[model samples]
Target: MRKKALKAAFPHTLPVMAGYLFLGIGFGILLESKGFSFLWAFFMSVIIYAGSMQYAGIDLLAAGASPLYTAMMTLIIQIRHLFYGLSLIEKYKSAGKKKPLLIHELTDETYSLVCSCEPPKDVDPSLFYLFISMLDHSYWIIGCTLGALLGSLFTFNTAGIDFVMTALFIVIFTNQWLEQKDHRPAVIGVACSAVCLVLFGPDRFIIPAMISIALILTVFRRSLEKEASDHEDP
Candidate 1:
C-alpha cells in the first residue's frame, strides 16, 4: 500500500523537490543569520511553507509583533491564494470526504499537477495527489531544517538571501506578462496599488488596493478586452 502511494506520488514530487531545495535552503540560511533557530525554520517550512511569508515572518516574529498586525500583514501577503483556491473548490470537491484536507495541501505545485494530469479512472486520484503534496512538503521541511542547522554552525554572510521572494515574484510577473495578451488587469493592479500607497501609506494600503483592483477589474473587464482588441486592429 505504501509503495503504491510512493509510486503514485513520484511525478509531482520530483518537480516540487527540485524547485524547493534551492528555495528552502536559501530560506533556512537567511533564518539562521537573522537569529532564528533550525527548529523555527523546519516548522515554518512544514506549516507555512510559504516562501515570501517566511521571509516576512522573520521580522514579525522578531519584534513579537501584534496579532492584529500579523493577521493583517499575512492576509495582504497571501490573499492571492484565496483566488487560487476559489478556482479549485469545485474541482477538489470531487474528492468526497477527503476534499478539505486536499484543499489544505493545495500549494502551487499541487495545483499545477491536479490541473494538468488526466488521471486514470478508478484510481482514486485525489488520494494520489494528496500523497504527492505531503511528500513534497516533507522534502521542503527537510531541506530547510538541514540548511538552518548547517548555517548556524558555519557562520557566513547571508545578506542578499533576502531577495528570494522578490526574485520569485518577478519571475511570476514576467511569466504572466509573457502569456497574457491583454495586460490591462496587470496595469490596473500596479496603478491602483500605487495610488493607494500614496494615499494610505505602505502599511495600510495593500488591502484597500487589492479590493479596489478586484472591483475595478471585474467592472471593466469587457471594456479592457475591447480596448485590447481595438489596439490590435489599429
Candidate 2:
C-alpha cells in the first residue's frame, strides 16, 4: 500500500521537487553567505521549513533581532498557514497519528498538491498525502544541504537568487488557475490584494488582504463549493 501510494504521489510532486530544489539551494547559498555553516542550513531546513520565513530569518539572525520581534515577524509571515490549515481540517482529520506530521510539513507547494490531487483507487488517500509531503520535504532538505556544501567549497555570485521563490509561487499559482474550473477564489484573492495594496501599500497590505480573503471565502463557502461540484460533474 505504501509503495503504491508513493508511486502515485511522486508524479504529482515532480513540479514541486524542481521548484523546492532550486529555491532551497538559493536559501542555503544566502544563509551560508551570511556566515552560517552547512549544519545550520540542514537543521533550519528540517526545523523551520517555512520557505519565505526562513529567508527572512537570515536577516533577523544577522541583525540579532529580539525574540519578541522574531516571534511577531514569524507570525506575520506565516499566518497564511492558518488559512491553509483551516481548508485541510476535514481532509486531514482522519489521518490519525500522521496528522501532526502532515500539518508540520504542509508548505505551500505541499498544500497545493495534496489539496488538489486524488489518490488512485488502489491507494490509501492518507498515505498518498503523507508520501507527497515526505517526498517534497526530502527534496528541500537535500537541496539546502547540497547548496551549503557548494557554498563552502566555492565562491559564486549570489545576487538575485532570492527571486527563485517568487518564481516558484508564480508557477504554482498559474498551475492552480489552469487546473480549477472555479476561478472565484483566485479572482477574489487578487481583487482583495489589489485593493489592500492600494489602500495600505505593500508592507501593510498582506494581513488585511489575507483577512479579507478568509472572511469572504467563509461567507461564500457553500456557494463556491456548490459551483465547484457542479463544474466537476459531466
Candidate 3:
C-alpha cells in the first residue's frame, strides 16, 4: 500500500522538487556565503521548512536578533499556514497516528499539492500525502546540502535567486485559477491582499489581508460549498 502510494505521489511532486531544489540551493549558498556550513543548511531545511521565512531568518540569525522578535517575525511571515490548516482540518482529522506528522510537515508546497491532488483510488490517501510531503522535504535538504558544499569549495553570485519562490507561487495560483470554475475565493484573496498592501504597506499588510480573507470565506462558506457541489454535479 505504501509503495503504491509513493509511486502515485512522486509524479505529483516533480514540479515541487524542481522548485525546491533551486530555491534550497539558493538558500544554502546564501547561508554558506555568510560563513555557515552545510550542516546549518541541512538542518534548517529539514526543520524549519518555511522557505521564505528561512531565507529571512539568515539575516535575523546573523544579527543575533532577540528571541521575541524572531518569534514575532516568524508568526507574521507564516500566518498563511493558519489558513491552510483550517482548510485541511476535516481532511486531516481522520488521519489518526499520521495526523501529527502531517501537520508538522505541512509546508506551503505540501499544502498546495495536498489541496490540489487526490490519491488514486487504489492508493491510501494518507500514505500518498505523506510520501508527497516527504519527497518535497528530501529534495530541499539535498539541494541545500549540495549548495552549501559548493559554496564552501568555491565562490559565485547568488543574487536574484529567491525569485524562484515567487515564480512558483505564481504558477500554483495560475493552475488553481484554471482548474476552478468558481473564482470567488481567488478574487477575494487577491482583492483583499491588494487592498491591504496599499493600506498597510508591505511589511504590515499580510495579517490584515489574511484576516479579511478568512472572515469573508467563513461568512460565505455555505454558498461556496454549494457552488462547489453544483459544479461537481454538472
Question: How does model 1 score by TM-score?
Answer: 0.65
Clashes of each: 0, 0, 0
For 1-234, candidate 3 gives per-residue lDDT tens digits of 888899999998887887888788878888988889999999998888878898999999888899999999999899889988989988887788898888888998899889888899998788888899889989989888888888555456656755656676788899999999999999999999999999999999999999899899999999999999998885
TM-scores, all candidates, are: 0.65, 0.86, 0.89
Give the alpha carbon lDDT tens digit for every residue of 1-234 in model 1: 545656766864665675666567777878888888999998898778776687788889878999999998888887767766876777677778777667666676666666555455555677776777777778778778888888556456655654544554465567677876878787897899999999999777877887898899789979986887786784
C-alpha lDDT values of all predictions:
0.74, 0.87, 0.87
Ranking by TM-score: 3, 2, 1
Q: Which stretches of candidate 2 lie above 4 Å from their native place? A: 152-181, 219-234
**In angstroms, how far off is 110's CA in candidate 3?**
1.1
The residue pairs in collision within model 3 are: none
lDDT score of residue 170 within candidate 3: 86
